[model samples]
Target: MDWNERYSEPGFTYGTEPNEFVAAVAGRIPPGRILSLAEGEGRNAVYLASRGYQVTGVDGSEVGLRKAQELAAERGVAITTIHADLSTFEIEAEQWDGIIASYCHLPSAIRAPLFRAAVRGLKTGGVFVLEAFSKEQLNYGTGGPQSPDMLMALDELKLELAGLDFVHAVTVERDVREGSKHTGLASVVQLFAVKR
Candidate 1:
């Protein structure tokens, strides 16, 4: 997907509001540096910054990151933005108090290593929060990658994120109203895990 082109459009592709799950789970994360992966437009990062977490948002699209910075500025909060692809973006070990991967869908080759790095990147007791479309989402057509390989499975994630002590993990159909792209009832996997 040409994220740059998508983001280059008039408004935020996923809206300016943080994901509902992210907002709901933010209080569980320790207050400190937070890393946001595939952070397309900085809604979540900006929201976290507003809550006093030092946020760093990383994304593949320069246009998206630019808009993210603008959003942060508009919100009167500061957040670092990094433009890099997930395949090559390095998640420094023991560097984050929290890490978020909301709606970040990628093929297994990239997703596997990225998820492993996310596990290693957190400090002990640091939390990892993720909410993404599940394989069942293909039937919903609300949003997310069309390819099944890009959709996540709860069991698969459990194996991929082995070191974390899961606080919550499940796949269910829920209403996801997020901008123009994602709307209506959708199938998704939500997870909140603490690094052991």
Candidate 2:
């Protein structure tokens, strides 16, 4: 399925509101240069921008980026957006103070490399925050890549992010209500780490 086409809907697929898990931890992130990965429709990026963070949003879809721009304008904040596929997009090393990966989905094959790139892109002591559906999300029938290999697991995250300093790592089933696309009891992993 063309994920980009799916995002072309008139309404926000993930909703206009930012992820609650993301919001809960946003306050902890000190203000600075921030990069938001796979920031479809720009909800989280715009929120971060509003909070006085210099935000840059990167995503694969032009349609999503357009919506993100609209969201930023709606919120009276400016955000820099880059259109590129995460699979190959290189995150600039030592450039970002924080990296936000909210619901960025990919098969394990692709995720490992992209995540590594994201980590390396952070400056020393840079914060990396992520929230993604766990393997158990299949039971929720909410929103997420359906393929098992595409879903995340605690063990997988532990290994993938082993080099980072983890401040919080947990896999839990929780209420997730965002755009129309993601709503219901979802199994997810929430991580807050700092680059060593």
Candidate 3:
């Protein structure tokens, strides 16, 4: 199935609220321009917008982007969205205060360049938050890309973000409720880091 089709079902795939980990640190994230990677249906983007953050959401699927806008309207928040393939999207340097990559799954080969772009997109001291499935997720059959190459662990993220200052990085098992697709005990790596 197409990426948008995977997310374009009747309900939100990851729910209509900000992620719990995101909510926990929401207070610390100073309001400013924010970019959300692979923002399927815009739950986090809309939530951030509601909290006074200027959010820019990017995704490849128009179907998903439209749903994201709908969610923003339903919540009475404003968010900027762009439909573009992250694989080749050129993220401007020093352009954002914060970036969020929540459950973005891609082959490692594809992930590297995209991740590098995510890092480069941030200004110095800008924060980047990521919560994604670990390879161990294959055991749980939870909500994540089934491909092992698409999953990640702390060690991998450490290597991928070699130059960043890590505020938090750990593998945690948590109950995730994101629409009907991402729910259950998810083995995830949560990282809060900043560019040097």
Q: What are the RMSDs of all candidates, in order? A: 0.6, 1.1, 1.2
Distance from true location, Cα of 118 in model 1, Å:
0.8
* Stretch of 10 with least lDDT, candidate 3: 22-31
| Per-residue lDDT of model 2, residues 1-196, tens digit only | 5758978988888887777877898888867999998898999999888889999999999999999999899889999999998888888888999999899888788889888887888888888899999988988898888898988887888788767898999999888888787878889999999888
Q: How far off is model 1, as Cα RMSD?
A: 0.6
The predicted structure with the larger TM-score, 1 or 3, is 1
lDDT of 2: 0.88
Worst 10 residues of 2 by lDDT: 154-163
**Per-prediction backbone clash count:** 0, 2, 4
Note the Cα lDDT for every prediction shown. 0.95, 0.88, 0.85
Q: Which candidate number has the best lDDT?
A: 1
TM-score of 3: 0.95
Give stretches of model 2 more than 4 Å off.
none
Against the true structure, candidate 1 has what lDDT? 0.95
Specify the highest-TM-score model's number: 1
Local accuracy of candidate 3 as per-residue lDDT tens digits, 72-161? 999998999999988788889889889898888878887888788778888887888998888888888877888888999888788776
